[model samples]
Target: MDTNTLMRTLDGTLTCTTLYGHKYRSAITGQDRMPMALEGLTRGKSLWIDSLVHFTCPLTPQQETQHLSRTPVPGSVCLHTPEETVTLHERGADVSFSEHDVPEDSFLSYRPRLLMAVTNITITANEWQHTEEWQLDLEEI
Candidate 1:
């Protein structure tokens, strides 16, 4: 589906298990510590979610140029209503990683390892939002 429609479908929050390690360590990626569990979120166009969830975040004007870097495992983010689970990386899927830094005083960076990175996530319009963004609680298939 188109970017606009995908954003509208995933207009709420999402949680991911693949993101836990990202919260405790550095975003620049030198410190490879143990993986931890992180529940990330995304919204209309104001907030930036975690690395694992950013591929489904809403698009901004400038991110149109950012590229979809290769994902080795490219974990999944699940949405509901159709009982759908969105795979963050598919061949030729349009995911952008252009970032907008969160100000030091902004609440977005109030946590331990919070970083405001804007990524545009586009998915099919047929899906619907889930009430709770708790993908972390799901067991491995």
Candidate 2:
């Protein structure tokens, strides 16, 4: 797996726009297209998306102290703002296959290869309030 440090800074409440794509093929038919959707998040939203979407919010001050002393698991990070929690986990293997090589037997059987490079992120109101932009770095740790 490729290793790189990522930095994300959240100075204030921010919104992010994302895009998605799909494909289909048949002997008599061809591929199709679907429109993308707009997913919303606040200062403290954390999420993971595969076929479906999974979200996690930040722990409360008490919960933070209890759960997040050093490193955090996937569920422990919480988003404290008014926005919905959202996370995106990209499977590089699933999306890496060639269109022609995809099996024709099952439409739903294809599971995209995803790489969990950065698994967890925790955001604080103070961090968002003081910073203008959020940054994340992935370094050898």
Candidate 3:
């Protein structure tokens, strides 16, 4: 099956779970929800969906490193590092992470150092299936 082509067809809004224990709604394009294309399909009669999901959040260095390290989710993988990207593949899904790449000391000094992060998730399901990505953000309020 053409994973890239199928990914382009599957697109929609997806729910994101955060490591801090919160859920938010984000806008997804055809390329973002590509995983949906595999809905109700099997390996013998199913196709692979290649979709990507992006997320942005404001967080501190301490929060980003500590909270994320202790997170207890198996689906979401940490692409820890400033301006770094990581790829994840699981449950017929492909995931990626992107960050602004900031230094710890610099991040701490920056007022309201809001970290902007993006996650590119790709997955394939036998049936129309939906998955969530959780991120934990810490604040010094």
Which candidate order results from sorting by lDDT in descending order?
Answer: 3, 1, 2
lDDT of 2 at 91: 39
lDDT of 2 by residue, 39-63 (tens): 4533233333232222232333222
Residue pairs clashing, model 1: 20-38
Per-model TM-score versus the true fold = 0.17, 0.15, 0.19
How much is the lDDT of residue 128 in candidate 2? Answer: 35
Off by over 4 Å in 2: 1-52, 65-78, 83-141
lDDT by residue (17-133, candidate 1, tens digit) is 343333222122211232322335232223322334233233343332223332322333211112333333322323332233322221110111133332333222222432222
Residue 115 of candidate 3: its Cα lDDT? Answer: 22
Q: On a 0 to 100 scale, what is the lDDT of residue 4 in model 3?
A: 20
What TM value does model 2 have? 0.15
What ranking of all candidate models by TM-score puts the best one first? Answer: 3, 1, 2
- lDDT per residue as tens, model 3, 1-141: 421222222466443432463333232333333334434433233112211333323444534332221212234443434555443322212222223343453221111112222233334333344443323222211
Candidate 3 residue 53 C-alpha distance from true site, Å: 2.1
Quote model 3's TM-score: 0.19
Q: Which candidate comes out best when scored by lDDT? A: 3
**Candidate 3 residue runs with Cα over 4 Å from true position:** 1-51, 64-76, 83-141
